[model samples]
Target: MASIQDEIKQTRPFPSPSAEAVVALMRTADMVRRSVASVVEPAGITPQQYNVLRILRGAGEAGLPTLEIAERMIEETPGITRLLDRLESKGLVTRVRCDKDRRRVWCRITTQGLELLRQLDAPLQKADEAALQALGNHDLEQLIELLDKARDVYRRIS
Candidate 1:
């Protein structure tokens, strides 16, 4: 297997291990995202849309406020209104104004949306498993711990 430096065809060594690790993390993330996209593309929904659906599913029958959905997203997405609009147009989600709080809009996944997610559940699991198959169980756990620690560093500094 080619190392990250070789894969990127960088002739010179990275300035530091931190820089190299950052580049490797980014490249690996993008590769995994692309793999996930390939799986979801056939279902006619982008990965972002699928993310919203799953979030709504977790929210249950009461649903969640628009802002709450945005907060719960795995990545910060600009123009959430547009994303919601697309999902609404596809009839996968419903947006309703909160009766008590007129300013807030509550979003819920439809039965169709639930069914779509159900269909995707197995395939998504398979894709995730395949993406991490190179790592043994212990290595995967350690990687998760290290990644979480790395993210926490930013959180603490910020």
Candidate 2:
């Protein structure tokens, strides 16, 4: 079977994709996610679920609401509710209605939830280590710097 690079091959010179950066970022994110997801899913949680828990844990006792958690999230918001639901069912988190606003619901990472996250610390670290193992220290730092600059450029533009 012919590869995409081969399929796009031409005898004559052609304009290269300005979209290569976008493709690289996306593919890198996908690879990183797949590696992490395999480790996370076995513990009965998705990548996003782990993200929310981590954020809540970082926030400590003050905690955060569903919306706040959603806002801080790197992914979509609607998914947070579902992720919270699963975590709640697993006895990892707790949901409580606010006193000032009866209609509003708030989420707090329970002790159990924090412990579960603690349990994943080593494995997640390992996942990151394994993902970047191929790249040398200096190259990895350079790659991270480049990605951060890319985000900053987008922020300045829009």
Using lDDT as the measure, the top candidate is 1
Candidate 2 lDDT over 1-158, as tens digits, reads 66766756653244455566677778988999999999999998889899999999988887788888998987767877788888899998888989998877778899988988999999999999999899999999999898788779887986
- In angstroms, the error of model 2 at 78 is 2.8
Superposition-based RMSD of candidate 1 using all C-alpha atoms, in angstroms: 5.7
Q: On residues 1-158, what C-alpha lDDT tens digit does candidate 1 reach at each position?
A: 65986757576778679999999999999989998998888999999999999999999998998888888888898768889999999999999999999999999999999999999999999999899899999999999999999988897886
In model 1, what is the error at residue 17, expressed in angstroms? 0.9
Cand. 1 Cα-lDDT: 0.92
Clashing pairs in 2: none
The C-alpha RMSD in Å for every predicted model, in order, reads 5.7, 4.7
RMSD of 2: 4.7
- Distance (Å) between predicted and true CA of 8, model 1? 18
